[model samples]
Target: MTSSQIQVPAQEEGGATILEIGQQPDAWREVGGETDEGLARFLRGITERPGLRVILTGAGSSAFIGQIAAPALRRHLGCRVEPIATTDIVAAPRDHLEPDTPTLMVSFGRSGNSPESLATTALADELVTDIWHLVYTCDRTGELGRAHRDRANSRVVYLPERTNDTGFAMTSSLTSMLLSCLLTLGPAGRGNVEALAQAAEHVATLQPDIRALAQSGPQRIVYLGSGALAGLAQESALKLLELTAGVVVTYFDSPLGFRHGPKSVLDGCTLVVVYVSNDPYTRRYDLDIVAELRAQLSPDAVRVLSCEPIPQELGTATVLPGLAHLDDAQAALPYLVFAQYLALFTALEHGKTPDNPFPSGEVSRVVQGVTIHPISPSDLEAR
Candidate 1:
């Protein structure tokens, strides 16, 4: 059924989650409109610097945004681009930070209050002699946003207020920040944003089939992709795990990477979803795995999410027609909608609350129980 026909109850446990997921299309448009000249000028100045390296960071789903965007940004800016998680940076600052490298830290946070996110910014200042920040967050009042608003070396770009998702899982917030980064720092433009929004609206039409599969009772779900799409696969896996509160097992990997050893997770009770890349060269590897899996598994066991059509023997496909021109990084926005829907329906089918899956506080919307240890200049010198 279409999104309008899904009929979520007013007081439903996952009502907010469903609403937030549906709101992404419009929120993305706002991202396009909000890409001001000042942000673009700031980024241009940083990219022109000698010996520059860009690091994209966040924690959890927020971190996945950097993974998906780094490849495209690296190509656009012609500089070193790395996607490092705030969790990793906080735990091992010396490994990822350089004392003299000119670096731009693009921090993505839904709530802007994640402890690791906050700590990583401070650590960058302490560790890097030449550092700049481009902070993208949903909450204006959040610590990350507040901390960087007036800083000399940082610029805070707040997305539309509604993009600050109230649900336990990030739906609108993730895509909004991702699109903002692409439009401002990467090669995406207003036209790309419009196309992505249209494609995401079309994803709602596939929900009926996605919901059918969710109800079919698969014990395990696997997502596979390549390049930037591999990061999309990772985020897709997290959405399912978080919404189900660990009731369902999930895994993610690149299509070729899966064959090395990870493909052993496949079984009659498992479902595999592949995010097909838009690039012709990368699409070859994606199709190879889909072909191999269909040969060994049930014809209905594998699903393909792509921008173009495949051979008839490939089984069911969710083909979004207008996205063929965009590269895999830009195409990632609509491709993610399908994954989001699958996770939402799977949680509903399993009788879990999509909004508050971990009601007992096993996990929280903003992470909990993290202690940001103090690190000094002496700590770096001793090392």
Candidate 2:
């Protein structure tokens, strides 16, 4: 399908159309005007619960959302925060949940109907006492949202209608839920979420260049990050694989971690995308990796794109315009947007539809095939 086929509702002649999917950052400004009372009430309920251990859960891209939010939530809310994938929670419940822990589980899902999504929610209900559920889902009437409505200690926040993207891959829904999580749980005073949204608008304007890199056919893609973005690296890798129908082999690792053995994966046909942190200490390690890679570069060995600009010595193409020391999650959006564009272009490059890369049905928008198991009493005790 052509890019126009997936055009966003707020499409402007020169504004960023790619970034407009999933509740655009600008759309959050209307949160209070449109649903302020609900958001306020939701926040109040979550914050009032003393000694609450928050578990953020989802699958695939959804799961990565939790990964990005976990550390920031802990730092901002001063609560015990954990990011557990629903897949893991379903396969092994005892490791993640504890009966005695007064838990608040925030679920992120695009369609709200993945079997693992349902299984994770059901397991939480079965295992925890004083359970509070906050579901952020794109589908308003999907299983997870409907099942939790009117139930005590359960609330569902359906994303804006525009965010319910029909494309096989998630673009708008991911950013919307991500922003929602950041606003609700991150260090709010550090920066305005609206400013971050505006930045997203800026990045959206650069889709053409970002998409070109993906179409250039670098045989492999490596995504690197540190701290909260470590999870983002993994998600970026997965997105490329899914959007390209696994035509591209992608890998992810921490900046420092890559040197141990993974660095060997780099070669002439690889495209290395690094998500550099703004923290001076963290950036040092990330920059070191880039320097090492450059030092080892052979003519036409690999094409490296640093998501943010680094010192010239690093020798890599900087893709997105730099954000001045924004919070990691906020900074991540620009990088994430670029990655999405790359995936879309990669699908197109392979003579595949950018909107629906998997036509034969091996993969899906909402995942399929899973079983939810009962939580045992012993499992409850250990949570």
Candidate 3:
């Protein structure tokens, strides 16, 4: 019944989630190599303008993808880049937008059908005058990708169909879209595409070991990292919670911040997964926390995750191979696979269905019951 016992793609038990997670390397390669005419046209348009703001917005996991990429994007683009959640945009639009500033809102979504994705896009169009939109989505047929595919000023990057997942939790869909946007719109996208694609493919070999490690049967999981990896840590925590149907209590935090108060959560039943940074300065802090936790808790309670080899002082780790060659933002595409496998196998080990996760119908694949109320002028003024 566990993932290690069953052959993958069997579709008998946790197959959908497993296959989606397993095929992420291929999905990244598929989207990363493709050339995008829409993104090219958007780049051309941007060069002609001045002071165009780029806002990266999404909901849930998609929003975290923006948070992971925004810092690097700002450094590359040398323009104002902001990652705002769609919920915030719909709830209070006035505070985030400047009417005269020509803005390019880059929206990231897996299904592109989530109500807030389209709601925020539409709201931005109505509120801003000189506006352009770029949507990165796995589902080209979904509302967000479909509505503006042919728009004159809008650009849509539709990832390969294989990345459009059927599982309740997004695996390929999330990573593929994130990788696609970074490659299509970010710097060195043209030349470095092949190497980046290979980096993801090389990481596939780690799955078996990771699957075995995930079967250790920890009831409480904590994921920690810093900078962009911190966002990935949050996504990893959510992925496990969703797959286990909330049976496994999960938490995510930065290495330095974990000491302030979050450290108290660890016990014998806990597995603290620390995502160590590649930067020397940040890596010291990450290793320090891992050492601190290892000394305080059971030795098996702490695990380090990184693209680079674990420093000698950090002890044992789960390394995603060849990812260290890429930057942290690009490295996230491969590092994502480890946490995904952990969540998937852990789901099966706990007697939960990875595909549906919540058989009780408490949660659905696409989110529901979120009504985006219109922001009246008076409501904006009241704030």
Question: What lDDT score goes with residue 351 in model 3?
Answer: 81
Number of the candidate with higher lDDT, 1 or 2: 1
**lDDT per residue, candidate 2, 286-320, as tens digits?**
87777676667642333443435667765655544
Position 190, candidate 1: lDDT: 82
- TM-scores, each model vs. reference: 0.96, 0.87, 0.92
Total backbone collisions, model 1 = 1
Off by over 4 Å in 2: 1-35, 38-42, 48-50, 189-191, 298-309, 316-322, 374-383
Clashes of each: 1, 5, 0
Best-to-worst order by TM-score is 1, 3, 2
Ranking by lDDT: 1, 3, 2
lDDT, candidates in the order shown: 0.90, 0.73, 0.80
At residue 239, give the lDDT of candidate 3: 95
What would the per-residue lDDT of candidate 3 be over residues 99-186, giving only the tens digit for each residue? 8898989998888999999999898888899888888888868999998898987888878877888888888888887887777666
258 in model 3: Cα distance from truth in Å?
A: 1.2
